[model samples]
Target: MNHLRVSGLRKRYGEQEVVAGIDLELRPGECFGLLGPNGAGKTTTLRLCLGLIDPDGGEIEVLGLPVPARAREARRRTGVVPQADNLDPDFTVEENLLVYGRYFGLRQAEARARIPALLEFAGLSARAASRIQTLSGGMKRRLTLARALINDPDLIFLDEPTTGLDPQARHLIWERLRQLLNQGKTVFLTTHFMDEAERLAHRLAIMDRGRIIAHGAPRELIAKHIEPQVVEVYGDGAGRWAREFGQAHSERCEQTGETIFCYTHDADSLVHHLDQRSGLRYLHRPANLEDVFLKLTGRELRD
Candidate 1:
């Protein structure tokens, strides 16, 4: 059975319809990503699935159980790493895991037994007695991830799991997530980083203005929505060059600031011209998920 299924899901706030007629399904052991901008209702959808709030319309089934009614029951088998760390300040690293494990109704002995492994999994074995305040940003994030696994859930929800993390920290988290997938765990992820979505999501959905506009395997979506090749020229003369070259050669073109992005089926002419221009900084590469995202969602900044 699918880990999660939502059909015709809808949610509203005052006059605004945040989630509109959404449909989604997650196969077991799949890392499904949900992408969207602020006010896109991504969080609301997560809440609806979790039964943290009731939907205005539609059906949601999590772990084969009907939601809102069995949301609590479904939650027991699902883990969550929220966008913000909620670890208690007073608790030690070990204490935090123990306390969270207790919420799952684990016996003292069982929780204790899991603590050592959980600490080690989080790379905090040496810091077991460390207070939450003493940990760095990355360490805290890892601890939160570890705490979510206190119950050894079958499904995990990670909301912007690497938001404030540095490159090193982000890579570590990615490695850990990979390990969980190897163990056959289903990961439901929400993130704004295109690279992260491309790397981790087996399948993904993109949302805007409270609805899913596009979704598929990263490469599939990229191939379907954008040109295969892209030439990004950025410098003082970029906008002018884009205006001229885009009219004659590119399938599509966009100019932001002093940078010009030319999307085309073939970039040979563009690259040849760029190479002739001295001191012109340009990148020629294959299209990626971000290209598809921008094409479908537009380049306007969301508030």
Candidate 2:
């Protein structure tokens, strides 16, 4: 059975439909990423899967159990690391895990037995007695992840798990998440960071205005939707250059504020064209997921 399944999923707030006729199926032990801008219905979709909210139309099966009907059964096998850290401020690091374990009906002895291993796994063994306020942002994030695992769930949902952390902290969390996949855990992730999605996700879906515009492996989507080369031009007269030669020289062009991006399979011709223009700084690089994202979603701001 698929780990999670959604077919014709639909939701609405008043007259505005938030999720429109969505479909998804996640296999076991793969990292699936949901990517989009603000107000793109990504969070609403997550809520639907988690049985936090009911969809007005469609069917959902999480771990083969129909959602909101068998939601408690599904939630027992699933874990969640929310966007915000909701760790109890008054509880010690170890105490937080113990308290969470209780929700799964773990006995005091069983919860205590899991605490040492969980703390060690999260690199918080030394801070077992420390208050939540004493831990750094990264440490707290790791702790939240550990807390979610108190019952050893098979599927984990991570919502922007590395949002505000430093690079080092982010990399640490990434490493730990990768380890979970190695242990054969299915990870469902949602994030705005393209690089993060490209680095960790085996498959990704980009949502816009309640619909999926693109879905596939990151490199595959890039190769299928966009040209191989991109030239970014900025500084003075960039707009003039785009207006003058964008249509003739490149397969596609996009302008945002003072910067204009030209996409092409033939970089040499575009480079030759731009060689004559002065006072405009340019960068030439291979197309990436961000290019695919922008091409599918356009350059307009969401909110």
Candidate 3:
């Protein structure tokens, strides 16, 4: 059975619609990614799914329970890690887990008994006695993720879970999330990092203007929506290159500021042309998820 389902999901504020007619499904043990630029309504969609806010139109079912009506019950099977760290600075690492477990009706004794195992899983077993304020950013993030699992939820909602962290910290979280998937836990997450989505998500949806413009496995989306190869020509004489050789060799070309992107079935011709053009730095590579994203969303800044 699908772990989560949404059909024609929509929401609005005044005359402006933020989430419009979105349909999605997630299977067990998969990481599903929701991606969009700023103001594209990714967060609103998440809130609606969580039943924290009512949608103006459509249906949402999380864990086979209709949301809002059965939101409380569904939430018991769901874990949430917000964009910001909301850990209590006054509490110790172990104490924080114990306190959070109470919301799921876990007794103090039960919560305490789970603490050691949870700490070990998060690599915080040695720091269980440390105060929250003394922990590093990465440590705090791990604690937050650990706390979310206090109730042993089947599904987790991670909102920009690794934002602002160094590469090492981000990879650690990714590894742990992969471990969760191995154990058959479903993860639904939102992220601004295209690379992150590409690495972790088994499938993803791209939202724009409050609607899902595309959804599929990352590789599938790339193959369907973008060229197989790309030649990114930047620096001096880039615009001239686009005008002269772009249309002749490429299936599509897009110019954004100082860079000209040439999308083609093959990059041999473009690479040959670049070899002749001195001082023009160019990169020929297989089309990536970021290329597909920029193609669909435009290279212009959202904000």
Candidate 4:
């Protein structure tokens, strides 16, 4: 059975609708990714699911309980890592987890017993007594994640969990998340990083302008929406090259950046065509989540 189910979820603020008719399901032990540009309603959808805000329309069932009405109960089994670190600067790493555990009705003794494990899980065992202000950006993020897990939640919600972190920090978080999934915990996440989504999500949904534009496993989405291979040709004479290439391979050409990208199932055929042209540099690779996003949503700044 699905761990979380959302159907026709809608939310609006004043005259604007932020989320419109969104539907999704997350299975046990799965990492489900929500991808979108800013103001595309990814955060709004998460808030509705967590019952932080009431939805304007539709239904949300978390752990088999209807949301908002059963929000308190649902919250008991849920963990959340928001996009920003809302950690109190005055509190030490261990203090934050202790306080958060209290919100879930864990006794002081029980919270204390769990602190060591939680600290280790978040890679902050040595920094347990350190104040939040003294911690690095990555350390703070890890602490936030540790605090969320204090309740031993069955399902976790992470909003832009690895945003702005260095490569090492991101990988550490990813490794910890993978461990959770291996232990049968479900993770629901929103991120702008396509590589993160592709690496972590068992399945995902792409949102745009408050609606889901695509949904599936990362590989399946790529296979359905984009060609297996893309040949990108760049340089000053790219337009002329594109015109000439488009005449011979019109069905395969798409213009992005200062280059013409030829999409095809066979890379050799496209490479053969490009070989005849000079003053052009080319790269060939498999399609990815970013390619699908650009194809479906177009390349435009959301902000």
Candidate 5:
């Protein structure tokens, strides 16, 4: 059975529609990702699913229960790690977990009994007595994740869970999330980091301007919308290269920043064409999620 279902979802702020219309489904044990630039309505969609705000139109079901009407019951089976770490500075590492568990109706004794295991799982067993303010950014993130799991939820929502962190810290969080998946927990996440979504999501939907532009497995989307290989030409005369190559292969060329990218399955033909031109140094590589994002959504800044 699908763990979550959303159909024709719509939300608006006054007369301005932020989420025009959207639909998605997530099966058990699947890691589904929502990718988009800022103001693309990713957060608004999450809020609608969580029943934090009522959607102007459409439906949302979590674990077979309709949201808001059954939000309380649905919440009991759900966990969330918001974009920001909202840990209480006054509480100790263990204290935070205990406090959050209370919201799920866990008794003090029951919450206490779960503390040691939860701390160990979050990698905070060694810092159980430390105040929240004393933890490092990575530690705080882990604690937030642990707090979400205190209720032993079946499904979890992670919103930009590792936005600002070192590579090591990010990898640690990824490993932990993978462990959760191994235990059959479903995860729904939103991220701007292409690598994060590429590495973790089983399938994803890319949103733009409050609508889904593309949806599928990362590899599938790349294959369907972009060439397997891309040749990136840089340095001086990049624009000339883009113009010349774009005219020769109008369907396969894109210019961004100081580079001209040529996307094609026949890399050798493009390479032969470039060899005749001077000041046209390039790199040939496989296309990734970023390439697909750029192809579907033009290189325009969105706030």
Candidate 6:
């Protein structure tokens, strides 16, 4: 059975169309990423898919169950890790899991039976007795992940799963997510970090202003939207170098802040020009998801 199906999905807030006619299909055991900037309706779409909020138009189904009609049943089989941590500071780590278990209609004995394995899975075996205030940020996040799995769900929803995490912590979370995917669990993820999406998502959709602009594997989207090579130059005289040499050498060039991005099919001539120049540093690399995001969404900041 398919993990999820959404067709002609739409949600509006007053006059603003937050989710404007979207459609999606997620296979079982696939990590489907939803990417967008602030106010792009990603969060709204997640709520809609879960039937937490009614859509303005369209249909939703989870595990062959019609949404909002049988949303409670669908949610019983789903685990959700929200963007923010809302763990109760009043409770200890183990207690937190046990309390969440009650919400899933699991008994105390049943919850206790699963705590040890869950703690071990989250690398929080020792922190089980600790209070929420006593744990570090990473520890808290790990605990939240463990709590989401308390129901032994078939599908998991992760909202910006690695936000504000250090590199090491993020990698650890990525590894855990990998393990879940390997276990044949369906993962629906929303994230702003393009690298995270590129690494975790089997296939992804990029949304802008409440609509999907691109959908494919990371490599496919990159190939379709960006040049083969990119050279980023910055430092003193970078602008002058870009104006004088970058335009002549690159197929396309863009200036953002103090950095100049040159997109080209071939970088040999560009590298030669950079080698001849002084007081400028540059990075030469293959075009990636971030390039596609910028090309489609623009580099402007969204609030």
Preferred candidate (lDDT higher): 3 or 6: 6
Q: In candidate 4, residue 196 scores what lDDT?
A: 95
lDDT of 4 at 34: 97
TM-score for each prediction? 0.98, 0.96, 0.97, 0.96, 0.95, 0.98
Residue-level lDDT of model 6, residues 1-303, one tens digit each, is 789999999999999999999998899999999999988999999998888999889999998899988999999999998999999899999999999999999999999999999999989999889989998778888889999999999999999989999999999999999999999999999999999999999999999999999999999999998999999999978899988889899999999999999999999999998998878999999999999999999999999
- Candidate 3 residue 111 Cα shift, in angstroms, is 1.3
Q: Tens digit of lDDT per residue, candidate 2, span 1-303? A: 889999999999999899998898789999999999888898899999999999999999999999979999999999999999999998999999999999998999999999998898799999999999999999999999999999999999999899999999999999999999999999999999898999999999999899999999999999999999999999878888888986578998888889989999888877877787778889999999999998888888889
Q: How do these models rank on lDDT, best leading?
A: 6, 2, 3, 1, 5, 4
Q: Which stretches of candidate 1 lie over 4 Å from their true place?
A: none
lDDT per residue for candidate 3 within 144-258, as digits (tens), equals 9999899999999999999989999999999989988998999999998899999999999999899899999999999999999998899868988899887689999988888
Single out the weakest 10-residue window by summed lDDT for candidate 3: 291-300
Index of the highest-lDDT prediction: 6
| Candidate 3, superposed: residue stretches over 4 Å from native | none
After TM-score superposition, the amount by which residue 274's alpha carbon in candidate 2 deviates from its true location, in angstroms, is 3.5
Ranking 1 against 2 by TM-score, winner: 1
Q: Which is superior by TM-score, 2 or 4?
A: 2
lDDT of 2 at 85: 94
Q: Write the per-residue lDDT of candidate 5 for residues 253-287, one digit (tens) a residue.
A: 87778888888887887777778887779888899
Whole-model alpha-carbon lDDT for candidate 3? 0.92
lDDT of 4 at 115: 98
Model 5 bad stretches (over 4 Å): 245-250, 272-280
Whose TM-score is higher: candidate 2's or candidate 3's?
3
User: RMSD to native for every prediction?
Assistant: 0.9, 1.3, 1.1, 1.5, 1.6, 0.9
Model 4, residue 233: what's the lDDT? 83
